[model samples]
Target: MAYQVLARKYRPRRFADVAGQDHVTVTLMNALTQQRIAHGYIFSGHRGIGKTTIARILAAALNCRNPIGSELRPLAEPCEVCESCTEIRAGNAVDVIEIDAATNRGIDEIRELRDAARYRPSRDRYKIYILDEAHQITDAAFNALLKTLEEPPDHVIFMMATTQPEDIPQTVRSRCQHFSFHAVKLVDILGEIRAIAAHENVDTDEAALALLAEAGDGSMRDALSIMDQAIASAPVEDGRPRLVAQQIRELMGTVPNAVFERILQAVNDNNSAEVMTTANQLLDAGNSPAQLARQAVRYLRNSLIAKISGLTPESAEGGAAAELLQISPDEQRRAARTAALFTEEELTRFLQTMLRTFDELGYRQEQRFHFELGLLKLVHLRRLLPVEEVLSQLAGGGGGSAPRAQSAVRPVAAAPAPRPTAPAAPADTRPAFSPFADTPNRERFQGISVGHQPEPVPVAKTAPPVAAPLPVAPPVPVAPPVAVAAPVSPPPALGVPPVVAASPLATPPGAAQPVAAPVEVVSPFSAPSTPPPPVPAPAPIPVAPPAAVASPFSAPAPATPVAAPPAPAPSAPGEPASHLQDAVVDALSNAKQGSASDAIGDANFILDGDTLKIQTMLSKIMLGVVVNADAEKILRLAVRQAGGPVNITLLPADPAMKAAEKKAKAPRSGSAQAKAMEHPIVQRAQSLFQAEIRNVIDLRED
Candidate 1:
């Protein structure tokens, strides 16, 4: 006989001889024993897991001229001595026809097979058609044979074996008995390889046998094929081939898992130099960077699995670890030891990094740089803390020193300042008392208590029970000189008025203020012949409620106390309002409202009698910022600062209004776009981000 590969030489003849497929074998055996055979059978699973082999054995068992054992107790296995079994095993059976579906997957071939299936057997009890790689058949071809496969004649049987069962049409699959085969486990492959090596009289160590089994990757045919290659390459000793682990490694062109284990150990130690050195050594030894990356990915995956399952060599037997990690015992132990140095998450991240690096090596020009960088990434990734841990540290509620460091660095201002002394009344804890919280009291102005009038009124004879003692005193006539001489440091007993009077423009409220005097000089006609004499301020605009008072001595107050009073409708001041425009523009620009500042800066400012008019041409986007309520308030405040108050009119150019009207008239309805525009959350986001809605997709079902 010619030299035969181990895959073929050790091919299982009877169902009982098949390994790692007891589920399929035992079920087929039961079906044979009961003689409840289906006309159409489909076998599908991983490659080389006996899908076609089981199909052929079932064929032999069905047609055996003299099946083993007696009628009372029949063995479901085929009788090898029978001529039908011998011809089938030798692939020369007259009645059995094996077709390579990959080559003949057209409708014409299927039509021929359909016509042939109608005939009776030539010599055997039944005619059998075994189609290998059946998934390769075109959809048209499967459709052509669907009717025949569904109701084949009793004299014919159709058996198909395919790696991808889903590629076969559902109509064809429904009519056939579909058996999904499992990938042969590592333990089963190891035992089978050991037996084959013994039978072939080849001397092999346990590591060499394990290596052969692992190289198969859970396929008996693949394992046997690798064994054949290993035996051919093994050195002959004492007239027999000797298979060693080192020789097998060289034949496979792969470094041992130990190389990766060492790399990971360096990573755990955060030694980037060692990692790069190891990668350099592996490349120098002639291992391809892409191949090295692939091996690293595999090793990392095994380590991740070991970390997750806590699988050691001694504990890996007959469990998920055995099925998941299909390597030898030594590899499992190596993976476990490596996994111990890193956490499950770190292993997962390492696997992910290597997986990405492996994919990049396929298309990247600089493979060596990417491979080294990928290894260096593993070293750096070890230093990273999980997001949950970081968050816990930030919360200052975790056990690690990270939380302590986080708490130590926190700003002292984060906590409220301690009160020097408690108030006579208990502080209000109600939400209404909070500045941010809304309260009805915030809407209107409150009463103001003036200490004295400018006309030198007499002091009150008796303190009114409703009035405070401080407001009963008359104003001192000599105070203006003392306040205007220079900046005054407030005295301990100086009240709120002294603080206001001590500012740079301390001339009486009615005087031509020093800041506003320059605006008059720009226009001769707008200036008065002589400046108006200083006049006492009018009754200080009614003060806010006591709770809203802004005083350094008092508790923190709401922003309402500092709000500028509404500008009067008309005030005939004797100066042009250019100073007001400059102030408004400067304020807007400093507030980061650049577009608004530009619009205002380009505007024409006219002081007609008592009204101030601002006119500018702006785009619709800029018009929104210029006319914003906050911007309007700032404009009015600037006018108040320039003089008493005046009517302020902002006239956006007609083109801007026309553009805005056109946009508003643009179609909007109850569609997703309209709803998204009108959504409160969406509107708030638009305002906050200064964005507009361009499109909206409705993902909800109709």
Candidate 2:
């Protein structure tokens, strides 16, 4: 007799013979004993997991002749000795019809089966029709079988089997009883293969059996089928075949577990070279890149499970994969260490990459390229250092010299910076904010203080009036006051510039006390010959703290005869002060009055009676120079230089000679201003220019 494949030879005949499908067997057994079986029954499960096997068993139980109970009490178990059971097992029963739906899936076939359902059984009590791969039935055909499937003949039993039940139309499915089957566990497949090997007297080690079981992937028929092929091809020793894992690996062109284990160790150590080298070695050894990718997925999956839970295959996948239990001690240690290397997120990424690579292996023409790229990708994953470890390495600079352990950018720890130094300030110099504080030049307030107000002075009966301050100019040199013996005045008020008084060398020994003195130093811009008439002496000088400079308002120190006033050379009569221009410029330049000196240099000097007048095109330029205190000193020196005291005034280039002559002709007394505005010529001039009268006076009145 010809040999039958283990998949068919070891097919389960009884519901009790089915492995790892207690749910379906129990429900069917209970339904049979109760005689409550549905007419249309469908079995759905993965391929080779007893979908058809259970269908045949259901038919045998329905038509068995030798019953365990009489008339009203039917038996659930089929008697193997009975004719119905034997004929169903041999596939020779007249009343039992098994149709392959993969081929007979047309509507015509479904209609024929529907018509045949009306007839009674020829030799059995009921007719049994089993359609395998029922999902392959056409949509129209499934629609055609709906009525007969819902209301079949009393003597007919319709049992259908399919690997995928979802493809069947819902209308046909609702008319049938459905049962789903799951894949056989790995241990279950291993046990079945061991039993078959023992029955066949094949010598095999547990490791070899584990390899065969893992290769089965999770199907009992596949495991048994592989065992049958491996046994037949096993090397003969003393007329008995020897089976070993190494021989099986060579025959299957399987990548060794050690190759994967080494690659994983490399992944943990972040060693890309070793990872790539080992991967290449496996490919060189005739291992398929696709197979390497898939095995890597499983190996990594086991490690992930080990890290999360423990290192037990039972815990890894409910003891489904028997090979996981057979790993060597080194493999176990390596897996545990490798498991510690990856985090959950990292493991997930690795699994995802491997799964994606396995999928691409079929589509990619160059399988080695994708396989190597994926391995390299895993190897280069950052050396995942713990938080505490990374911090310690940073704290102790010696640890970073090893390979960097960063994924994207290197995690370089920066040393802390040295503390900054604060600037020191002198206590005495620090600015005081209080307004009443006696500190001069409040550092923060730029030397201004509340108590620095200018003191009020009573005008002296004979002293010249003080001039107004000048406008902005280049910094001028200060005049060297010939050691003024006058009392120091108080400092000016906060925000006001200081005023200096002119003082000269002592008078001659025989000179009488100053009474009606010639008007002092005259400004070149002055319009009047003498200073404004003095009224009275200044009030008593004020007193202030000793830390402050002598109060500018303090009484003048009595002058002793320090030096006699120098006598000047007598000038020829009516001599112009033009020779004194150099003397005036020299005095102003020494006084550092730049603006006044500039104006003096730019003007022409002329002598007018006793007064020296400056002639200029623009009067505004000299306005500041004339008001300048230094200009006063320059004018005095010019007066003494021209051989006598004389007042100085500024005049425009175009003189008002005609107006002066007319004014000399028309003036009366102090009230001459009113008479001049009433002149007929003045009225005509006002009307012609649309001008208003401001004031008018005789030039000789003062």
Could you say which candidate leads in TM-score? 1
What's the lDDT for candidate 2? 0.65
Error of 1 at 196 (Å): 1.3
Cα lDDT tens digits, model 2, 212-303, are 87777667777777777787889998888888988888777776666777787788777888988888888887889998898899878867
lDDT of 1 at 23: 90
lDDT of each: 0.70, 0.65
* Model 2 Cα shift for residue 391 (angstroms): 16
RMSD after CA superposition, every candidate: 15.8, 28.2
Please, what are the lDDT tens digits per residue for candidate 1 over residues 2-105?
Answer: 99888888899988888889999999898987788999999988998898888889999989988546662269888777888999999999999999999999
Give residue 430's lDDT in candidate 2 (0 to 100).
32
Candidate 1, clashing residue pairs?
none
Which runs of model 2 end up more than 4 angstroms from their true locations? 69-75, 312-337, 383-702
Candidate 1 ranges with C-alpha deviation above 4 Å: 71-74, 312-320, 393-702
